[model samples]
Target chain A: MAVTRETLLAFLSKKTRADLSKIEDGAELFSSGVVDSFVMVDLMMWLEKQTGARLNPADVNLDNFDSVQRILAYAASRAR
Target chain B: MSGKPGIVVLGSPRSGTTLLRRLLDAHPNIACPPETYLLSAAARFLHADQFAAGLRIGVLDGLSFAGFEEAEVLARLRGLTFGFLRDYAERVGKPRWAEKTAFDAFHLAEIRRLCEGHVKFICIQRHGLDVAVSLRDLVDKTGGYVQELHDYVRRYPEPLEAMARAWIDTATAIAELADSSEDAISLRYEDLSADPAAQMQRVFEFLDEPWDDELVGRALAGTGQVGFGDWKTYARSSVDRSSVDRWRSLPEPVQVKLAQICNPTLERLGYARIESDDDEDDADAARRRYEFGLLLNRMKNEDS
Candidate 1:
C-alpha cells in the first residue's frame, strides 16, 4: 500500500512526543526545529519497518524527509 | 604530540554535550569515545574516594582506581585515558581525537595539567529550564523520576540548584582560563540548533581541520536509527522560544518556592527576579540583595 500523508502523520503523532497538530503536510520539520537530529533517525527507522521501504543515507536528506507529505512521496517513489 | 590535536568537549550533563561529541566525531579528522565522565570522576576522587569509587563503578562502567594512593591513582587513570584515546584514534584512522564528559568541567585545572597542553576545550551551554525539563522527562521515561531525583539529591544534596550554579561557574571558569590560553571556545546549544551548518563550520575551523561539506550535509540530514530500542520513536519536538520563561509556567506556589530557593544563585547569574505586579507589596529588593551577598560569601567559602 502506498503510504498516505494521514497515515504517516498518525504514526508520527503516536510514536513521538511532539505535538503534530501544527505540522502541515508540506511543513519543514528540521528547519522548524519540530524534529531534532535524534528524532529524525527514529522516524526513518519507523518508516522503514512500517512500510518495508529501504532508505539509503543519501535518500535521508531534508528535501526528502522534511515533512509528512515529502516523506510519504519518498516512500511511494520507493514502492514504485 | 603523539597524533593530531586532542579536543575536550565539556558541559553539564544533558546539555547537548553528547550531540556535539557525535557531530564532531562525524568529522573525518576527529575521534571521540561514546561518552566518558572522567573529569567529574577525577574531582570526586580528589574530594572523597569512596563516593568517586561508587560513581566510577555505576556511571563509568567499572572504571575505578579505588584502592590506590592519590598520586598513583591519578597517574594510572591519566595513562589509561590517554592510552584509550590513542587506541581509539588508531582504530578510527583519525589524526585528531576528542572526548566529552560533563564532569571534566569541575576539574578543568586537573584536566589541563594532565593533557599537558595538548587539548582544546569546547564548552556547551543550554538554558537551565530546558535542561531541568529534559532531565525530568528522561527520569519519567525511565520510570524513576522520584527515585532518581531523590537519589541524586541524596548524593549531591541540591542537585538542581548546584547544577544551575555549576553551569554559570564552570562557564565563567572556562572563560577566565581561556583568556590566558587560546585553547577553548564556548558555544550555546540554542545558537548551534538555530544555525547548525555555520556553527559546525566554526567548530571545524577552531580545530584547524578541513571542512567536509558532504559530511556536514550528512550530519545535518542526521543518521536514521541504525537499529531500534526505547529511543526508536523519539522525535525532537519544536521548542517554543518563549518557553524560556518557564518560571511563569509553574503554579504560583511552586514559583514562589523556586524563587525563594534559587533566588540567590539566579541573581548571581544575572537572571532578573520574577515579580508579579499584583504582588509588588510583598516584594523585597533590599532583602534579595542581602541574601545574594550571603550566598556569594558562602560560595567563596566553599570554593576556598
Candidate 2:
C-alpha cells in the first residue's frame, strides 16, 4: 500500500520546497533540480522504509528515480 | 540576464569537446572552465548536503572550509552549481559560462533541469574510427582509460570491439539527447576543422553571442595556446584536417571492424561510410541492415 504517487510527491515537495502541483508526475526529478544526489539517497531510504526491501545497486539508476511515476513503479515492483 | 547564457558542452571523450572548450574559453565574455566530478561525485555521496558542505570547506582533498562550519554547506549541487558558475563569471567580468564534460551525455536530463530556462548545450561528434584510434592512444599512453571505458576494453577480447562499443554508447547517448532536447544541438568535428570561423559563427549564433569573426579567426591562428603544457597540445589556431582521416591509416581489418561497428552511426551523423568497393552496395546494404539489427539487439542486452 506504500510508495504511492502521492507519497513520493509529498516527499519530493518537502525536499525541494516547491509546491506539489509544480512538478508533473512524469517530470524527471533529478534533471529538473527537484532532487540532488543527497536527496536521491534519502529517496532510496524512503522507498526501502515503505517496501521493506533493499534496492540492489543495479536497480538504482536514473531510470528508476528519474521521475515520480517511475519511482512509484519501481517501489511497487519491490513491494510485490 | 538569462542567467549568464549558461552552456554545457559534452560529447564522446576526444570527440572535440576539448577543442570546442578551448575556442569558447577564448571569448572575452565567456569562461568555459575545466571538468569537475559534479555529477559522478554526487552519485557516490549519500549525504549530499554534507558533501556540499565538505566541498565548500574544501573537503575534497580532505580539508575544511575556513569560514563556514563543516555541517553548514547545502547538499544540492543542482541548486548551487549554476550559482557557482554565475559567481565565477561575475568575478571574471564575463557574461557567459560553460562547462565541458564528456559524461554529461548520461546526465543530460539533470543538466537541463538544473540549468533550466537559459541553458544551451553544444554536443560535438567525430568519426568513431578516429575516436577509437584516439582512445587506444590514450589507453596506451596513460596506462588507463575512463572507468566506463576500462570495462569495455578489459572485457572484450578485441580492443577494437571494445572501442566500437564505447563509441556507440557515447554516440547513442548524445543522439537520444539530440532527438529529445530542444536546447541541444550536434556538431561535427570534421566541419570545424574544414572551417573554424564559419562553424564558430553557427555556434555563436545558436548561443546568441555577437559573432566576432575577427576574434574567432585570431584565436584559431595562434593566440589561444595557453600553458596547456603537459596536456601535450590542443586545437591550433588554424584548421588541421590531418586528423580527419588519420584512422584510415589503421590496419585494414581494424578499419573494417570499425566500419562494421560504427558505420551506421557514422552515416546517421552524415559522414560517408568507408567504402572499399562501390559496386557491392546492393548486397552489402541488405546484409548490413540484418547485421545492424542483430547488433542493436545485442546492445540492448548489454545495456540492460
Top candidate when judged by lDDT against the true structure: 2
Candidate 2 is graded, for docking, as incorrect
Candidate 2 residue lDDT tens string, B212-291: 76765555554444532114335355556677777876644356657877888888878898764213225644354444
Candidate 2, residue A53: the lDDT equals 84
Each prediction's Cα lDDT score? 0.59, 0.66
The alpha-carbon lDDT assigned to residue A32 of candidate 2 equals 64
Residues forming the 10-long window of minimal summed lDDT in candidate 2 chain B: B56-65
| RMSD in Å for all candidates | 20.5, 23.3
- Mark the 10 consecutive residues where model 1 chain B has the least summed lDDT: B227-236
Residue B100 miss distance in model 1 (angstroms): 0.9
Pairs that clash in candidate 2: A31-B110, B48-B75, B49-B75, B57-B65, B220-B237, B221-B237
* Pairs that collide, model 1: A41-B224, B40-B103
Candidate 2 C-alpha error for residue B249, in Å:
0.8
lDDT by residue (A19-71, candidate 1, tens digit) is 68667788887557676544455466556656676666456565677677788
- TM-score for chain A in each prediction: 0.79, 0.89
